[model samples]
Target: NLGSPDERPALYRERSPVEHAANLDCPLLVVHGVNDRRVPVGQARLYRDRLRGLGYEAGEDGDFEYVELGAEGHASSDIDQKIRLFRVLGDFLDRRLG
Candidate 1:
């Protein structure tokens, strides 16, 4: 993941996925943990909002998708939570590639 945009403005902007969102030609599925301290959920929301502003539609079968896992941090130690996250990821991959 890229460093905080505040700390490394140029590098952050250069590496940020959001900055390159407009170039995206395929679908995108963004998954974020609500409790993530390393990368706050707001970052994901910002990207989604910006993509929408750039005329990207969001839905399970649209140009972009977002999922927020509650009670989860940057990464989870809970087995069940991991499984659930992976399932969501797998579903996304299947839909995108299917």
Candidate 2:
């Protein structure tokens, strides 16, 4: 790790995905587990909201999309949930790269 953001402000800013939102040229799909303790869902929500503020849209065929899974922690425990997440990711990539 580069160290905590408080200790390395410049490096943290450079590494933060949210800081480069304006430069995004491709579609984005942000997925998060609401029950996540490590990196809370709010962080993902903030990123998606920021993207939307910068003129990104949210939809299956839009420039940006977000998915929140309930009852899921840092990682989902259910195999079905994992499958769904992968499917969504695959579809997102296909639509973007096709």
Candidate 3:
């Protein structure tokens, strides 16, 4: 497992995508679960805001998309939620790669 951020600050900073927002050159799709305990939803918000600060607009036609599932945890188990997640992924890919 990765070490504690407090004890390994350099490693954590190096591994954080938000820390490297300036290096992003492609469209990004960020999907997070609001109930996720492993990785708190705040991280997602930080990343989105970071990208926006770097001039990356977020939307279906923008440089990135952020989706937060209200009832999901780290991994979704509900069939309907899974379908919606897949659809969002597909739509993002289609818009970016199709």
Best by lDDT: 3
Cα-based lDDT for every prediction: 0.91, 0.86, 0.93
Report the alpha-carbon TM-score of model 1 versus the true structure.
0.87
On residues 47-98, what C-alpha lDDT tens digit does candidate 1 reach at each position? 9998999999999888988899999999999999999999999999999898
Candidate 1 runs further than 4 Å off: 1-7
- What is the TM-score (0 to 1) of candidate 2? 0.83
Q: Candidate 3 residues 1-98, lDDT tens each?
A: 88799999999999999999989888899999999999999999999999999899989999889999888999988999999999989999999999
Question: Where is model 3 more than 4 Å wrong at Cα?
Answer: none
Report residue 59 deviation for candidate 2 (angstroms): 1.1
TM-scores of all predicted structures: 0.87, 0.83, 0.95
Q: For model 2, where is the 10-residue window of minimal lDDT?
A: 22-31
What's the best-to-worst order under lDDT? 3, 1, 2
**Distance (Å) between predicted and true CA of 52, model 3?**
0.5
Global lDDT of model 3: 0.93
Among residues 3 or more apart in sequence or in different chains, the pairs in candidate 2 whose N, CA or C atoms overlap within 3 Å are none
What's the best-to-worst order under TM-score? 3, 1, 2
lDDT of 2 by residue, 1-98 (tens): 77887899999789777899998897777889899999988888888888889988889888887999878889887999899889989988888888
